[model samples]
Target: MKIKDIVNRDVVNLENCEDEAIHIPGLIQPHGFLISIDADKEIINVCSENISQFLDYRYNEILGKRIDDILGKDFKETLREFKSNSLEKKTVFLTYNDQSYALTIHKSQENIIFEAEPNKVPLNEEGNLFESSKRLLSSIEDTNSLKELSQSVATAIKNITGYDRVMIYKFDHEYNGEVYAEVREEHLEPFLGLHYPHTDIPPQARALYIKNLLRIIGNIDYVPAKLYTYVESKVDTLDLSLSVLRSVSPIHVEYLKNMGVGATLTVSLIHKGKLWGLVACHHYSTKFLSQETRNAVKLYGYFITSQIDVRILNEQYEVAKKANEYVDKLSSKSLEFKRDSLTSLFQDDAIYQLCNGSGFSACIDGKVYSNGETPTEEDIRLISEVLFDIQSDGKVITSTFPRQNKGLGSVAEKFPGINFHMLDDTNYLMWFREPTIKNIKWAGDPSKAIEKDKKGLSPRKSFETFTENVKDTSKPWLQPEIDACNKFKFFFQSFLRAILTNEDKEKQRILTENLKAVNSELENIGWISAHDLQEPLRKIRMMASTMLEDQQRFQVTEVAEKRISRMSKSAERMQTLIKDILEYNRASSEEDNFEKVDLNDLLQEIKKELKETLEEEKAELVIEGYLPEVSGLQFLIKQCLLNPIHNAIKFKHPDRRLRIRIFDDQNHSKSDMYSVISIQDNGIGFDNQHNEKIFKIFSRLHSKSDYEGTGIGLAFCKKIMLKHRGFIDAQGQPNEGATIRLYFPKVS
Candidate 1:
């Protein structure tokens, strides 16, 4: 159905669904018996209809009885000694009537669940878990691609476990899963590429999958064993999330029965500590895996996950390499039109590769550049107003018009594909995406999962090929498109800064004038609209916070938690951007109250502003010796100092204490008309070749994982220097440190 319906209902709606929860089923799989004991170490709960067969005690007598009363004194002491090791899965077995019984004890939500299964089959003492693991590992050792790896994984698991069918199910961003790979008997109908809605595996079930990591059901049609407990047991329901023989949800069992599946086994494929996907095994008839074989499959899952990670990294590297090559080509073509840097800072082709569009537009300094089938200048200004209204985490906004998504409305429809990359806050890189109508294939009807029935609203379970011809929508911007924007934006901005940050005074003066001229329009409009736009973003952040705090009350489970966390992070980023925009506007203002500024006083003010951050990072800021007074804008000087110093702390080396040493020997000036101040930090250093480019606006070398920032700090420092009629420069060696030297002219 519709995404909005699913978004609001997926977690909150608790209609009778077999997948939602099974822990409190009040029943157990007939294959085993379940008993829960609280802190008092007495039998507080039971679910076995045949407790006598396993424990040789009456079900009613077991309630409120200690283990000694049920299994005798020596066995209770043996259980205590077994539990003292604090192992993940503790076990002890006893032959109660010439029959071997296997007992497993594991703690769940502070309550210990005692599960005992009859060792129905004769033990094969010769079976080797390690040998089974090695065979499984060797089966897929040479797989190099995801497709090959997935195929190998499915085939190997099927062969090792002897299941009738094995499926490699992978999850998407929205939790919807696709059967990526499958291996089954040749006569069976293929479900190779079928997709399953997220409703099929509700929040509680997915959470259980994450907790247990492996699960098995011996038979779908077996009757559930009823649990009996004292009326004063205090626990109305047992948290069977970690139980190996937890009763399968009745609805889930029915769903499986409908599909003609008899038994099942599944293992989680985890990547970077998150549930990535699963290896779901199905049988046409009743089946069971030996404990040793189960352990072997688990170990095999670990290697498969690692291989998946490796293949993903390789694919990403390939994509990035290709994008870099494309950027280099775009840069080469752009040089032809940038004949004169002063007349046209952007020849309209500068951002074309960065934004794959039929038309391109750029608003920077006070200048506007446009080419191809772009919106009218007035329309561009109007669209830019809308662009300035919304703030995003990545400083980029994209929309597919057919969905009637937010940002630039009819303007996006006119072009079909629209992307606005905020250079800072006001200035942007805009592209008009040409429309191309095409048909999309979905594995299911894609209707809302919830439907009203005779029993009221419930999840719909119809999956069929639904085709819809999407119109007025350009090709969607994939992750690669996003990477393209981020990568080339870095390149283009660095190119601009390299041209501007020159030592030659005449060239610098010419370029600085052009920079201000091209970007002045954005600065003017941005200041007035900023305050009004900020409140909505704050409201959005507040909503996210409220939802997260009340998550449990509203039944916002793991699924909604992830989405809300992302929303919170994005909103926080937006707020930071808005504030940065405000600071930047004020920092760039020409109204100069240039005065004798004491360097020591400014540093102290900044230190006060960053006190909490300094304490958190455990960083030390050292000012060496006496500081010289310079004639400069106090606010402008603060902007210069604030950004660099903050960055020094932000990118501190995790392994060592951060040290930022400010050295001002005042040795570089020959005529006393200029004095130099160097801010040095022993943090992640960059290559010397990129030192000049790093000062450019939005120039960043490391990704957010290595370090996170909008890449506007040093750019502001450069501008603040240019405002003071002084100079700022930097020198760095990779992994050593970086020194940003600010040359304040008229020091005397």
Candidate 2:
């Protein structure tokens, strides 16, 4: 049958063959026919090229004939075995008459069918071996990680040795072998990270590897002849076990056979006269080797292993150099922050200013520090103790105390956090924060467990199983590539630092300009509140004084009392306007004691403060939903809500109640937390044209006579929101109540 016809199908009848003689027509032309005999050498059947070819002998005559008479002893035995076995379909390779044939046997109820074909060997005819090796070397040389180098070495050895599979088998401290890298003929599995038991390659074999450095097994099944020597009747014994180039041990071959491997070539990767690892090559089929080929491959193996050694040195140099650069930059950034000096100016007793940990302080030496509640000396002492331990080992360390330790180092135990690195001999860089769910798992295989697993499974199975095991277990390590990329971190950090520093300076300049503008505006408002508003009140006082003095001549009447009441009302309106302006100014000023305060708690507090106002207005400050937790000043957020909610109640269009709602929006940036609080009112709303105007101080659409007080409430709301790096906007028609939309950013 053709190879394609029998693919994926079961072969039948070959399992039991009664006839000794079988027809094998597909053999070599000179041996076109095959004759089979039973164990007694009796000719059971004969197959010829044509019916006439077998005409010379009748079927009864051939059946009783001794097959060895014509077919020879070897041919008879080969045929006898074919008819005796129980394999339904059999494919076996045999060398007969110096020709190799892939003989396929099929059996039927009445007869046996045999087919034969030549098996071709693959030759390295193109001499692409050196080119393949060179390409592999070039591809791997750029790998800057030990893991990457291991993988590259495994792949290169596979190509150079022409092995079906090759692996970089590293020996652990316990002498257990691990496959750090592997390349296979099939893509079915990976074995790069499997770990195999130490017994796979026994202790004696491992020790021999350290001394010999190179081993080549040409044919695993080959047996060496016994040697005998004598000179002048003196005999000398040669210990084959001690010879580096001696043939492989028979026991080792049996071991491999038990594991199903036909051939293995191992090149020891020696480091300091010990076996660090092996460039292990495996062949599914037996391999034949020439002395010249063996030596050449050994020399090539030496070159590749040396490359790995040198590459590791280069990588260490690179890491140290890059780390030093970043450390220096961090030092420079800290000094720069200190020299700037304005952080002190921005400090307030009630606020925890992150002067030392805002920008550069938070980002020095790959650690981020932030301004929050200042740690106590006790906490600092505990933190120093932990830092001492981490500095010694350069690994993550943590400690904790009950009841929320307030000492300096308590932050380390207070939160689940990770930060550890070698900064210097005396100073180890580290970051400690409360752990969140985000830190428990990250998007990386940093532990390299996958690489380790493959190494563990390598030597426990047959060559096929080992090959398949490796293909299944190997995991590519990319961190070295990523770590190498960190070489540019100096440039990146410096660039970012420069941008941030310049921006800070620019922001200071802008703040100065803003402060000037604000002062000017406040001065102008001062004039309105002091001079303008005062003049109306002064006129009312003078008019009242003159009227009282001339009361006898004027005969005090109801008309006079009404006129006086109108003038007093206008004066009182001016007083209220001045007070609103002062409140709005306070909201917009940058001098507030800003600090972290729970937004939810602040909102509740504001509700309590405005309880009387809300009750009197018969307005339910519904607080429609849960308040969002945000980082801002407690007092400021209280003011933010107070102005808006109070306005909602104060301006209620006589027949309606006030309602406010709060919730968080998830549409913000990944790192930002955004909360929106919308305060809606059933109050007398203004025209859309005045939406923008209402936010300005003293800008009012309704007269004091129509409304109760000043228009500064909305303006104050806008100021407080802006102070928090937030915003507020109004929406409504002239008759409908307004909805003041508030957006509070999650982060500053």
Best by lDDT: 1
The segments of candidate 1 whose C-alpha lies over 4 angstroms from its true place after superposition are: 1-21, 43-47, 72-78, 87-102, 120-132, 329-361, 365-384, 397-420, 430-444, 448-452, 455-484, 498-748
Tell me the deviation in Å of residue 103 in model 1: 3.0
lDDT of 2 by residue, 1-748 (tens): 1011101111121221211111111211211223323333353343322212323443234443565554357655666677687645455666655656555554433334343334443476226556766776787667777777777666665655678788888876667677777888884355566666555565667766765565656556654322211122121222222232243433355556665567778878787677788887778778744333444456655755667667676766654555455434433443233323224312221111111111111223333333343344354345545555645344432222222224433354343232334334433323333322222121122222112132222122233322221111111212332242233333334444665787789899999999899897976677566656676677886777677568777676878867876777777777767766666656655476667666667777777887887777677766555656666667667777777776666677765565555444344342254566667766777678878998987777777676676767777878788887888887877668777777877644
- lDDT (CA) per prediction: 0.71, 0.52
Query: What lDDT does candidate 1 reach at residue 12?
Result: 28
TM-score of each: 0.59, 0.32
lDDT of 1 by residue, 179-240 (tens): 88899999987877777777667677877788788898988888767776666665656667
